[model samples]
Target chain A: MSERIRDFLRRRDDDGPCVVVDLDIVRDNYETFAKALPDTSVYYAVKANPAPEILSLLESLGSSFDCASVGEIEMVLATGASADRISYGNTIKKERDIAKAHAYGVRLFAVDCPEEVEKIARAAPGSRVFCRVLCDGAGAEWPLSRKFGCDPAMAPDVLEHAHRLGLQAYGVSFHVGSQQANLQAWDFALAMAAGVFQEMAVRGIDLKMVNMGGGFPTRYLKDVPGVPSYGAAIFGSLTKHFGNRLPATIIEPGRGMVGNAGLIEAEVVLISKKSEQDEVRWVYLDIGKFHGLAETMDEAIRYPIRTEKDGAETVPCVLAGPTCDSVDVLYEKTPYPLPVSLSIGDKVLIEATGAYTTTYSSVGFNGFAPLASYVI
Target chain B: MSERIRDFLRRRDDDGPCVVVDLDIVRDNYETFAKALPDTSVYYAVKANPAPEILSLLESLGSSFDCASVGEIEMVLATGASADRISYGNTIKKERDIAKAHAYGVRLFAVDCPEEVEKIARAAPGSRVFCRVLCDGAGAEWPLSRKFGCDPAMAPDVLEHAHRLGLQAYGVSFHVGSQQANLQAWDFALAMAAGVFQEMAVRGIDLKMVNMGGGFPTRYLKDVPGVPSYGAAIFGSLTKHFGNRLPATIIEPGRGMVGNAGLIEAEVVLISKKSEQDEVRWVYLDIGKFHGLAETMDEAIRYPIRTEKDGAETVPCVLAGPTCDSVDVLYEKTPYPLPVSLSIGDKVLIEATGAYTTTYSSVGFNGFAPLASYVI
Candidate 1:
């Protein structure tokens, strides 16, 4: 945890659980990305953590924004970032929402199908459009399904459809996956984008940019390759595929930008076992799946936890949230190891919660307030 | 769909998706439960949908509340219901929250372990506490895990611990499961409760109540046994197990009370295939798992969807929410079939969404507003 977060928690007198984000970590992450991929533009994914503080900080540091909706576009514009710096990154958008984003001065959009291209062509007239191709997302902890992208073979037609309707067919895009661990995952995705570029070239349409979407992961239980490593691999792949005719590149980093910048402090509410023969104890916390830990669905994301009695002997425990819903259990299939001496009312720290925690929190599930956030 | 909701939708000029709840359906459901189990008290679970209109209506109908937190207790009390009408039903709670509920005159709580019983004893003094035992959750669409309850064999000691403290050991509680289908599910749970009652009687502590927790099913894509069948089955179990010494009974119904009373109307954003050879079409909606349909996680709850072209030829389609997140896809593992004529911008109706939709919505995931609710 950052020292700023530690100091904030030490002085906190709050009644419920909360997350504290250290802006210094975010700044450092941004500089690392900038220095690593000096030629590519960094478009911070607003959906990751859209706190105004983080947006303003990135804006001041000359980072662009990848917005998923008109609401996110407005948030980026509120940071005084020009519309040209904002990309409507979500491929599935309502036609009315596309019109609203167009009115708000956003001219860049992502499309995966001809129907979506037609919507943008009518609503955002002369907007620049990027066609997202499918990636298997094989090595991602939270592997993406075939939901967001179309086949790479179909992308040329989607862009040609956009070009036919007075829209600018500007580029190609693909996401390896979120929290991706494999360093070479981007190479295969880039090869697919290069095929799309070649197909578009056969049609006399020169694609200007290649949007290498977010796959850079944050450190959870295991260490991830640094941004420099990702940059070296991506640059190697770009040079191998494009030769001297390299396209302008853009990278959207959501979790990698803000994942480790925040920490969540929660209290142990209760600890008990089902029976005398039960080998595992159940640890109940003040926060749970509905509160902010929704990523634990199917135990996909295992976050590191710490307590005051950390050095004490530990036991395998089934951790859960303080909700009446049965699905509120967090770690059960694979039990989380917590201190055996962990008693009721003792505080516990959940690490690497900076990116997706606050936004995934339910409005008032089981009558608990949304996760409180403080940007230090 | 109810004519009341249809009229509401006909008159609505608002943008974006919304859920409209017809209070008449809720009233009918409550009356059915009352007539079915004439001897039992109905404690409406507030976590289902804590809208003020529903709470006030239920309060006016002389219904008690099963609240999961102090905030829910406050919401119930705001409806002018007396403190005696509220039970702190969640087994996991902080000591300070227990004190707050005690200060507000709530005298009943649920517990599964000695640690929790000690907390209630110290904080709420002579409040009545019920011990929840574990249920296998057999034949349940949304089967509950061993998260909220202790083993059945261990309940007597927990209540004995409560009795040793200043707290009153009132009775036992168990949830068969949410959306439980089998009529015999309650038979096994009631047998377990009877064993606890016999154990308590042997200890010279005559337990006066048996809190049969909620597992009542609501109509979704399939027809479930009605409230009368559940009532009859439970009564048979009580008579057979208790031998005419039946305890005062309480039923907490969250989904059964409100699930069928509301309908969500959403606009189709896009419809596309991943490839030219792909057979299934992906249908994206304006509202998704984050917006309020969180029950669709794992496709466990298959909500019945309706479209204007329902009579047309059908094809299997993967439905998704319009967000950048890949996990937002709803019915993918087992694709839901839709009319072949369904196209972008067409209105689709999601039925039986009253219970868990509104509260499950994120604050603003992907910049989309929380699911709007209207009680007519």
Candidate 2:
């Protein structure tokens, strides 16, 4: 947390879970990646926060956006980001969605199969397409190979069909599973892409881009090693493999870029009796499953919790939302005790929930509206 | 479920999980419950589906509402439901929320603590009050005994304070756990409430209501013997316990009323091979974690999925969502075969999603927006 953030926290009235998106931290993260991976254009995945203010910040930073839906594309457009800077990348789309994207002037799209090619051809006949190849690097931990992307063996057929049909076909893209713990997965995926690129060359088709889909893990929980750095060991290998000849590279960083940049300051609604188990006692927060904290119960990711009033004094308490459901628990286990002597009226600020916590995950259950975000 | 729904599925040019709420079914459910529980006023839990249209149907059916947040109260009010007819029943609330509910003219509020009583007195002094009591139906599987509600022992003190403070204390409310399998649990809670009411009467405090908050089960899967009919057994016991002295009863029926009235329809985006599992197959749908289906996933509720086309062959398949996250699997298992051969373009509909699926539970994740409900 920055001194500015601490200073801001000191001044705000913590009535409920006030989502604070730190523009400074977001710019820092964006600058860090931009300075490190100068070769690739960053597409700030709008699915992370999509707050127009945050999207404007990324647009100011000159980052492109990878939108998976028409709503997201509209969010970016609402920020006055150009359509060319937005890629309609979710290949499996409805025909109406394809036409909508084209109507909105999204020229480039990701394609996974011949069926998708036919649909795209019908919807946006002149659109530039990227053939998504199923890379073997999708290991057991992450399973993108199952639902998306055409098999590498079938990519040639897709490329040929697109060429024969008059739909403008471009490069290849593959996601080596989302949030792969192993950095080698990307290397394996790139090598596989290289094979596909070579195969396309054999068939005399020219390619222009290679999109490495977003899955860069955000440091949600502490001591979880931050995403594999974009420094020498990784980007150096990328330059070594594709060389300067590597297609204009694109990386969608959703959680990694913005996950740690925000926090929700929620009021303590009530405190139950101390638990007999070593597990921390629970303090029910005023915000719940509706306030973008759905991932806490669903993904089991612990949002670092602390008492904003006195950060040093903390005890382990399983923070729960006010929903009547049992699954509304935000963190099953944590060291943060209910700020001692805290009553129903006190405030507890949850840390590092900047990513999927709110914008994408506010299942507005229990009558709570999706919380309003304040960009600090 | 209906031929019209089947026709809608046949006419869909694009596919994914789309839920349709039958207004007629909602009205029927309301009538069924209303007829069964005559003296009781049915407060349709807006947390089930706060869609204005759905709420309007319930409101038109002469049902009151149980609102847990200001948003839900606002949604209910938007349907022209009187504020007095809606209860801001979330025991855990912020000062602003209490004030908002008061501003919205919601006079009936629930409080779990003396501090909350003080706040309510200060904020909405004239509001009708219900003391939330912790009815730990012993040996029952309910988890909410850990949060909200004063123990029966603490109730007198709280009630005494409310009476002394000149707050309009009226009733008691307790939530049995969701999908409460044990109907005996109601007897235990009512017995406890009866004792509390008698003790309050002795203290010269008059009570007007005993809200048995929602926990009524919905039969989504086939195996569960179905929600124990709260008919003669439970209400008859309540009538015997309270007799002619019983206040107007309030039941927050969420799943029971609406669960069977809605169906989520989705198109099979992909049918892929699983590597390790036996003949692993996945049918990726449009609705991901962003929809209310996430609740079904988190709760481990089995949603029956069926494929529909004009007239086609059927097949069995596990359903998944479009999000890149592996946890976005909708169904880890399906009992019956899909109604038709689920090609990449085919559509599938999951039944019994009316209650907590779309209305209260949807975050715009993976760039996927919340699905809108159409009244059929």
Candidate 3:
């Protein structure tokens, strides 16, 4: 945990679970991305954590924003950032929402299908549009499905449709996946994007930029490669494909930008076994899937957990949230190894929680309040 | 859809997706349950919807409440219901929360382990506690894991511990599962409860109540057994297990009580194919998993969807929510069939969504507002 978070927790007098984000880490992370990719622009994905404090910090640091909806666009504008700095990044959107974003002066949008392109064409007029091509999302812990992007072969046609409807066919974009460990995953997607660029070129419609979508990893239980490694691999891939006629590039980093900057401190509510013969102990915490920690669905994102007795003997325990719903169990198929001395009311710190914890929290599932967030 | 909800939709000028609940349907559902199980008391599960209107109506109808947390208990009490009618039904809880519930005049609680019993013994001393035993949740569409309850063999000891700590060993409780269709599922659980009751009798302690936790199904894509069938089957099981020495029974129905009373009207955002050669179309809706349709996780709860062009030719389509997250896809493994004439901006009414929809909505995930609710 960051020293700022430790100090904040030591002085905290509030009850219930809460997440503490150290702005220093977020500031440092932004600089690392900026230094790693000197040419590529960084559009911080607002859906990761839309806390106004984080947005203001990133805005002051000259960072752009990638918003999923019009509500997020307004938030970015509230940070005093220009509309040009925002990219409406979600592929699926209502026509009215597109019109609203256009009214707010957001000129850049991400689109996959021709139907979406038609909506944007009427709503945003000459707004710049990027066609997101499909990636298999291999080698990522939380791999994305085919919900956002279309086939790589269809990108040219989609952009051409946008051009036909009086919208600027900006470029091609693709996401490898979330929490991606393989640096080589981007190579294939970049090649596909290059193919789209060539296809667009053949049609006499030049795509100016390549929007490389976010797949950047964050350190959890296992260490991930630094941002510099990702930057070098992506730059190498761009050179290999484009050969000296490199297009302008943009990278949307959501998890990588903020995941390691936050920590959640939760108290253990209860700990027990089903029976005397049962070997695994079930540890219930004050927070759960509905409150926060929704990323633990399917145990896909195993967070690194620490307790006061971290140096003590460890035992594999079934971790769960304090809810009546049965699906609230965090780690059960593969039990989480918590300190054997972990007791009821003892505080446990969950690291690497800054990205997707706050917003995913239900409004009042089981009457629990939303995950409290504090930006230090 | 009920006439009341249809009328509400006709008059609704709101732009975003909203759920309209017919209080008439809820009243009818309560009457059905009351008639079917004449001997049992209905403890409406507050986690199902927790709308003040629903709670006040149920309170006026003489229904007790099964609350999962202190906040839920407070919501129930706000309806002017007596605190004696509320049961803190969650098996896992913090000591402070237990004390809070006790201060709010709640005298009954659920416990699955000795540690929890100890907490209640100290915090809410002399309060009645029920032991929840684990049910395998077989034949349940949304099957619960072994997160809430303990083994049947361990229950007698748990209750004895509560008894030893100056707390009343109330009775046994078990959930067959959510969306449970198998009528015989309750047979095994009731038998286990009977075994625990006999053990308590052997120790000269009389357990008074058998809290049959909710598992009753709502009509979705397929027809499920009605309340009368479930009531009759449960009564038979109780007779077989208890042998004319029946304990006072309580049925906690969340989905079964409120599921059929609500309908969600969501607008189609976009409809398209991933590729020119792709056969299946993709249908995007204004609302999704993070909004209100969270029960559609794994496509387990397929609510019957109706479009204006329902009678026209149908085609298999993957349904998704309007979010940047790829996991927001609703129906993909088994693509849902929609009308070929269903176009963007067409209204689709999702039926049987009243129970779990409103509460599961995220607090502005992807910058979308929480699901709006209207009870008439």
Candidate 4:
């Protein structure tokens, strides 16, 4: 760890626990994401980390935001992002939420069901809308079919309903699912979405936007290959399908933009032996599942723990959280190279935890406060 | 869902997604936990939902807090719980945490290492402490023997170190792991603690307290007979072992007190047929893995879903969460007997989610606001 990181950990207030975000890395990540798709508007998924500074940084990078709730809209609006740039992406929403979106002048929203269509139409009669279609790619990491999207079979009818309500249903949206290994999944989904739009046009509805919803892949560990560049492939496919008539494209990338930019700094509390099972050591850290790192329960990615000196000395340690609950383990059998001793008070960094880290906390446990970020 | 619960959900500003906590059931749970351990002063574990309201309720119920951080001490202090009543139960802590605890008049704390003893001696000078002993019966649920406790073999040396510091070394504390299925595990732990205390007495260190650190079981599901009576077998064994001369027993029950008192009320988002698995269907709800229900992960606990009318007819549904992540499943093959006419707007009460439900959250995604709770 740099003296800077150690300085921050040492400065933790006696009153609360915190997740220290690196705004400088976040900005660099935003720039990298923007440089990849210069023509496409990247709607930073506000769900990643809604810290005001994070939103401000994304806005500074000229990124739009994909909001799911009225509070998200308010958060983005508070950052002074234009309402035209925000998309209320929840396909299924309550009446009050729809009303709040319209009241706040959020023009673009996704509609997955006719009930949501009716709700949006009644609440925001003239809003720009996107019809979310469910496309199941067999090889995607997580398939979004049949859950949050309109079935392809129902797409034409959805467009018809949107037109009947006099709403400018101008876009088609599909989520390729997060951490997806197959970049071709986006190609297949966009092709299917194009067919849906053509089908909609045959039924007399003209579309003006195509939102390839946020599922951009991100890689944390160095050994794993960096996520494939879907921007080039997606743009290539979209151009081939629409033939220069392609609508303004929007991409909502949450984890991709921020997942790898943050690091969680914690300290080893104690080391213990469990049994004859190779001296299972427990390193109780100050952080817990409440920090964004534990959400990787879905993925097999383990952030390699690097000590203050950045040496790879390996030792097998079970990283447990400060919470008394036994399930508060960050890693169960994580191997840390051990030539150097890991005693109490040694600071360790768990990498790539920026996105959902601080924003996901209830901030009510004890007086434990959420982490704050400063631009390095 | 009750009208009151509906009121909590409805009052949400539709800006962000949130977990709603019912403070009413929390107050009732404090009373229930206190009533069960009438003779023993209950030290409510601050780790479980350490909201100020929770601390206030525990204080109002005449229960103390088992704090793990200086921040937790301040949280309990803010609730008007005397600092003397709070025990810094995290056996291993930072030197700064020790300093803050001493500065704030927190005398009772737990120590697990000789180095920690040296640090605390330098930081706090004369702290009344308890040495945590590693009891062997740590069950599969959550084993503390891995991280925070010292081996019983080393207890004699730890007591000697504390004695040399001239600190008032009160007693020994042992956790029999959280969620232990073996009720016999508690008795075994009590016997082990008793032996350790007797050993300490032989070493000329008079012990005044033996905290069989709280792992009292609570019910997670209906017909799950694993959850035993909190008052009978476990506490009864403590009395049987130490008789009238037993030290002031401190039990830090975190989840047991609040686990069953609350339920998560959510709306069914999508009910979809699985294309590959012929008989498998997915019923998605608005809650996600970020909610406290994720505790059911890897555990046999089934957070049974029920309708407003308790004995409604049942149907089998695979309940999933709203997150785009595929792992955001709430229950696998949950047999929910649903009404034949069940629709999208139908409500569900996720049972036994009260304890850490609202306190543990990933509020980071899109203005997801915490849910509001109504006390009945």
Clashing pairs in 1: none
State candidate 3's DockQ.
0.91
lDDT of 1 by residue, A1-376 (tens): 9888999999999889998989999999999999999999999999999999999999999999999999999999999999999999999998888999999889999999999999998999999999999999989887889998898889999999999999999999999989888977899988889889998999999999999999899999998899999999999999989999999999999999999998999999999989988999999999999989999888888999999999999999999999998889899999998889999999999999998899999999999999999999
Model 2's CAPRI class? acceptable
The regions of model 3 sitting more than 4 angstroms off are: none
Worst 10 residues of 1 chain A by lDDT: A183-192
TM-score of chain B of each: 0.99, 0.89, 0.99, 0.86
Q: Write the per-residue lDDT of candidate 4 for residues B1-376, one digit (tens) a residue.
A: 3455568666754433334456666676666666665667788888766656667777887888888777778888998878888898876577788888988888887887677777778888888778887776556355553566677777667767877997777888888876666677778877877787778788888888878676655565534223236556667888787777767778887777666656677776656543323354566667766655657565446666666544554456666666544456666644445554455656777766656666565554445555544334
Tens digit of per-residue lDDT, candidate 3, span A228-272: 999999999999999999999999999999999999999999999
lDDT of 3: 0.94
Candidate 2 residue lDDT tens string, A104-139: 989888877777787788888888888777766453
Query: Per-residue error at A367 for model 1, in Å?
Result: 0.4
TM-score to native of every candidate shown: 0.99, 0.83, 0.99, 0.84
lDDT measured at residue B281 in model 2 versus the true structure, 0 to 100? 52
Whole-model lDDT values for every prediction: 0.94, 0.72, 0.94, 0.69
DockQ of all models, two decimals each: 0.91, 0.34, 0.91, 0.34
lDDT string, candidate 4, A282-320, tens digits: 676677665445664533556656676555455666766
Error of 3 at A1 (Å): 1.1
